[model samples]
Target: MADIDFGDAPAWVAVVLAGGAFVISLLARRDSKKSAGAAVEAVTEARRASDAGVRSAVAAEESLALQRQEAAARQATEAEAARPRASLALHWQGGQIFHLVNEGTAPAENLQLLTVSDDAEPLEPFTRLGVGEVAEFLIMTSLASGAPTALEFAWDGQEDPVRLRVPRSG
Candidate 1:
């Protein structure tokens, strides 16, 4: 057997050291549990904040898409409101005259005129006519002496060729 020597430490000193070490171990275990619980709470809070941010981003994207749709609709309406329309008529008190007029928001383009009478000469074509404009043509034949004559006009709306008819008006 090996001989153990305790020069100055007594038996009571050993007991006191063991008891203090046990108390310190218990306190350290309790503090570790509390720290672990706090860490779990922090993780849960971070998850919640991330979820809220994602929801807010989605809502903002949807709102921007709706605004784009509204702007497109407004542009379409404005385009529809800015198209030209043409009408032709015959007028006379002591002379016969053909009147071509534009009655729309925009100018008429490439306007060609035609009269139903077989003896009338071919009329000239107008390149461009503004809104509320009047183009007058002299008619050699009297419109009041015969059956109603039909007037036809063809023009461009920048999309498709448009045509309109007017009954004889004297």
Candidate 2:
């Protein structure tokens, strides 16, 4: 018969280390759930903003002629669809400045500047407005990347976002 023994660390020491690792895993699990919840909220906000955008698009026909009288009627319909429905106008005041007018019957919330290119990039920092309010923002050229683009107003997924312009800087 032959006997063999390996010594240096006790069995109980290894067992305690394993137990500590298990406890840490349980703590981390809770933190992961919190992060997941935040992600879900962000997705919900984006969906709401997207829904408002779709309705706005439908109001403007694919005919692509804003010069027609019908264009005014379509614009009115889109504006009416806004939350608290407000009239909005987007104009380039030059030198990276833009004018946003909210002349509608309803207050617009989370009114942010969004630039649409081959990819989505946020233009000016987010701004909010009430009915009959006008605000000006400096457009960041970061939004002008990729291609000729449309810069518009969005509600940060909270209200209606409007498509306002095709920039001349293309």
lDDT of each: 0.66, 0.67
Tens digits of per-residue lDDT for model 1 on 51-140?
999999999999999999999999998876654444433344334565666766667677766555676654677988777887776545
Steric clashes per prediction: 0, 3
User: Model 2: C-alpha RMSD to truth?
Assistant: 31.1
TM-score of each: 0.52, 0.37
Q: Ten consecutive residues with minimal summed lDDT in candidate 1?
A: 158-167
lDDT of each residue in 34-55, candidate 2, tens digit only: 9899899989999999998887
- 85: Cα error in model 1, Å: 7.9
